[model samples]
Target chain A: MPREITGFSNPLIKRVRSLRDKKHRRREGLFLAEGLRILAEAEEAGFLPEMLFYARESAEHPIVRRLVRATEAAGGDVIETIPDILHKLSGKENPQTVIGVYPERIVPLSALDRSSADIWIVAQSLRDPGNLGTILRTGDAVGAGGLILIDDCVDPFSVEAVRASMGALFTQTIATARWDEFVSWLRAGPGQLIGTSLNTDQDYQMPTYQRPCFLLVGNESQGLPTTYEKDCDILVKIPMLGKADSLNAAVATAVMAYELLNQRRAR
Target chain B: MPREITGFSNPLIKRVRSLRDKKHRRREGLFLAEGLRILAEAEEAGFLPEMLFYARESAEHPIVRRLVRATEAAGGDVIETIPDILHKLSGKENPQTVIGVYPERIVPLSALDRSSADIWIVAQSLRDPGNLGTILRTGDAVGAGGLILIDDCVDPFSVEAVRASMGALFTQTIATARWDEFVSWLRAGPGQLIGTSLNTDQDYQMPTYQRPCFLLVGNESQGLPTTYEKDCDILVKIPMLGKADSLNAAVATAVMAYELLNQRRAR
Candidate 1:
């Protein structure tokens, strides 16, 4: 039988709530994956939670019962809590039935399995969590192998990013690298480094993206710096027919990624 | 000389702040465009603001100075306020140096210039303001004719949507229609109605999109209803290689739009 808790002051509840903040999430090396979909994805990806929290009504749902059983089978704790606890954990009026605490799964760039993925995304100093998450989801949609976060990008495990990813966080490989570290890894390349910028006249669709390609994208406001663009094997730009100067970073990435996928599929 | 307002209680300031809410925006027939980039895009699109507000420090900047002069020249009010007033209007701790109030510009489907565009996007019951805005931006990037909003979509003039558009709101033609009304208009066709859904196994890129096509997309949660899909000339799905069941509505729209652009460009 699962433990039942009602108090807001419970130690476990406090710890789970603390996962909402990046500092605490990083320090503890754990993040929360909420809702039935994310929990299911985590389970399918072989990432059972350390703790599973659910409301009484949610636990009554057939899917929640199955998830609870799965968590128990994976040696995870299953706890039943009041709606108020679920609301606190999720910060939504109608919180989802399930929230799981899982360890942060990011690996260093060197540890990434380069053998399987033909394309990789390297995002530099990305500031928005939603864009980072959307890129992850888009990367997964096109079957990109992994994501490399270069420099100080937003936390991929952050709540907003996780939500925007729509559960791709559990399905995709994420790697973090410093500028020097990323550059050296690319130089040891199995593929080309393609960067997108506004300075170039070349249409993004013009390129025949080399396999195992690492597509490097820049920050939202300031695009790729000259130093960074200089390092790329080729630079491309998505044509802008309107007055708006640039596509939103995530949208631009998606256009390029899908174009690459389209090219490969055609061949 | 432009008027300087010192108090937060000013009626004009209150009215500008109220633009944040949909009710107030609709009631007054106005919305806001903030920051230098958006303001510049609006100016370039010939959608000048009715009133311009700026901080004292912002007024000292070259672009702000030019914008203030341009607003005054264009028969619009140019007001200077304290940073707090700008903050309240923007709902950001660090507000942009400038904010502008502009009238809502949506037109009915009957008024859209159908002959000018070879492609358009019809978003059915889109709920997210940000996604709608991104779609607008993406549509503009691909040189699509316009956007059609079906029943109960979020207000395109909402602050979040307008901001997400990054000024594409001014450049793109937006029309609203009911489901029945849209069907009748499609029957009086200038284009083919292409619907995208996961229910179909036909890959999205496989089709040679018909020109002047209307790409119909469903709501975020409940995708295109069978009834809606039944009316489309062709139904297609973006392939999913990973665990995510569906792409974000905006991302899916971008992928389809760009694929069409790529096909056209190749020809």
Candidate 2:
């Protein structure tokens, strides 16, 4: 039988709470996810939780009960905690009442694109954890093949990102690839390459991305760096009609990805 | 002369710290904004600060100095304190070394459009504060004329929303308008109404968007509402070639908004 952590001071509980900080996440190589919807998605994706902390209140919830069964069947511990204990352990006043501990995931490039996409998003130097999470969730929803982070991206497995992603991170494939590797892969792919830029001459719709393609988005503030300036095969723009000249990195990337998705379906 | 608070135990400091809570925000009808950039934006937008809290260590920053001057000029109180005190007073560790207490913005609908875009974004049932903030920032950066909250959307002026906006909230006109009033306005505008829906039968390009108009986005989990189903004159989709069925709310809205922006520029 697995151990039941009745208090927040329990070593395992302490370790789980420590994940809210970057250091603990790195040391343990673990992240945290909550909410029944997210847990359900994880279960559907064939993820096995190491521990399932469920609340008495949520025990009646179908998904929560299902998750407990799934974890038990997977040979994991299912610890039932009172609502107050669950809240203390979660550090959230309104805890979801269902928490899971799963291993950290770092998607491989090969596994990311089991099949190609009409448009794939490459995030370079995007540092905000919230933006990264939002982008990953959007990429998953838009059905992008995967996401590529060139350099200096905040870890996608961070707690803030997991909360922002609401579990879409598991559904999306993310790879950390260098620039040289990206270039070679670009040359190998059948899709056209498009990158967002401020002064780009090409309109977003100028090209018909009929096949698999790459849509690269840059940092939160300064866009594509000068080094990658030459790396772009074609520069496209989402025209600006006001003084504010840029969109949020994730939002811009999703829009570009949507354009490609739009074209593919139209054909 | 406005009173200057000098102690950590001051009631003003407690009230300022309470701004971090949603209930406090609702009760006080005020919110806190961090950093010098947001303060400047708020100041420029004529949203006067009632209390300016500056860390004694960073009162010399040019932007911080400017905020001080603006607050003084506007008859607001400027409170200078040690970094620790500022952190305590501001309800955030490190607290940008500076923060300003500003009034909640109530954007009048008539002030939204002028020489700018006829393209607007009406988010119906957007639930995430971060997503709303990202969309607000993205909308400003992409030169969106305005943003209209249709129904069941989080309060856009929430602290999380303002922080995610990245200073874009003060740059554009944002208002909470009823769904019926806003949709009628979009329909009356010079553009076609495009809405993303799981029930859509066409791509965004299918109808050719004969008029300048609004693109309606539904909540992240729930796509555009069934009630607004009939309001969308053009029902379009961003095709999903992968596993996910939808994009994050902000990303999807940005993508849709920019498509309209791109289309306008092409014309």
Best by TM-score: 1
How does residue A173 of candidate 2 score in lDDT? 72
- Candidate 1 recovers a fraction of native contacts equal to 0.71
Off by over 4 Å in 1: none
Please report the candidate that would top DockQ against the real structure: 1
- Candidate 1's TM-score reads 0.97
Q: What digit string (tens of lDDT, one per residue) describes model 2 on residues A1-267?
A: 334567767777777777777787778877777778778878887786788887776678888878888898889878887677667656777887787877777765655653455557788988888888877777776677777888778988776677677677887777888888777777775666678897677778778764667788888878988778777778888765554567777777777777776677667
Off by over 4 Å in 2: A1-24, A56-70, A107-118, A177-194, A199-202, A207-212, A263-267, B1-6, B10-15, B21-30, B42-82, B107-117, B178-194, B210-212, B231-234
**Candidate 1 C-alpha error for residue A211, in Å:** 1.4
**Model 2 Cα lDDT, one tens digit per residue, B101-123:** 77776575565653356667778
* lDDT for position A20 in model 1: 94
The models' CA-based lDDT, in order, is 0.87, 0.74
